[model samples]
Target: MSARPSPIFRNVSSKVGIIAAFTALNLATDYMLTGLPNVKFMDAFYFIATFEFGLSVGLPVVCFTRTAYAIVNPLGAAPGFLIVFLVVGDSMYVLSGYLSRTFRLVEKESSAGDRVLSIGLIGLFSALGFDLITNFGTGLSMVGGSGLQSHLWGALVFGLITMNFPLPLGIVHEASDFLFFSTLVPSSLALLSRSGLITTGPLGRVIGKRGDNQN
Candidate 1:
């Protein structure tokens, strides 16, 4: 006669497995796409994990993936300060995912265009926040000394304006995130739903499967 647990809390070991799987996937994708400069799918995976499984699964995945990638990057390990910023910046996707789930931003009943728009907006804003925070952190790490405040502000501005310069790395980063979020994330969810794996969370509406069957 005990009350049933929420679906999110029902599968502890499976959820842990999911966390490890996502972290590994993020790291693999980051390494595979290292040459692309800012074009990584980490954000999309972070958002998808969070949106589907909630903060518990998302936080560990984000933390482990970002930390591992920063310390063992193909381009060389990031500095301690930069690594901290990278983790913090990437955590924004967790917040974005939580908000998206809470608000049911990408409901199963929504039209394809609407779903795309919702996920795209989330991706766009989350990417912007990630870029700003990490770029500022990059700037701060690059500058130091007497006029720290002024120098920090100047560096932040410089980082933003010239982030891509002749190459447009910044644009590639944001655009790729939007593309991945809108298409891949939802498609992944749908695939899971079709495979009968997604039976909970906001995505429960997918393929008309409800989370209500649980006792």
Candidate 2:
């Protein structure tokens, strides 16, 4: 019998490839969308993680992607703001991914009613959570004293608007996410079918069985 690949080896190779690809994709998209400050596409990566890879993968992926972006951008006049952005942004994405996964709201196979409820709740919670956490962090890191109040108000307004309306940047983020998942999920499902992990069937019927027992 041929020797099997060690689990550690297989896992390392698989994760390395996946993470590298994801990082490249994240960077490329950020670059392409840089001209349009009103539009951000990297949010799609987080959405994809939540939907496809589950919390464990999604959380780290979001955090790392945000950290990478911060490393590249180095935002704000103060270096401290840059540091806070990295930490706070990463934390927000991780929280969003974990919440989405825990709530089972981002599941691809959810019903319409479920979809509406899940997406609405998840969006509200995520937007608010990120806004609160990041605002506080930003205030602490960059601004001082009464700046916290201003930041809090800003977060609340930004969170409410972005979560509810189609702000230009938010639109781009959501559209990219929808497009990415629309393509990726079908391909994944197809691969699963071919690999015998899943099977297609008629409504209310199982595959591989020619049944006429509707009596």
Q: Clash number for every model?
A: 0, 0
Tens digits of per-residue lDDT, candidate 1, 1-215, equal 22222234444556777889999999999999998888888899999888777788888998899888888888898998888888888999999988777766567435889888789878988888888888888877666647867888877986797667777877888898889888888888777656765554552322123443322
Give the root-mean-square deviation of each candidate in angstroms: 5.4, 11.1
How does candidate 1 score on lDDT? 0.78
Residue 193 lDDT in model 2? 48
lDDT of 1 at 155: 75
Of candidate 1, the 10-residue stretch with the lowest lDDT total is 206-215
Per-residue error for 98 in candidate 1, Å, reads: 0.8
For TM-score, the strongest prediction is 1
Clashes of 2: 0
Query: By summed lDDT, which 10 consecutive residues of candidate 2 come out lowest?
Result: 1-10
Count backbone clashes in candidate 1.
0
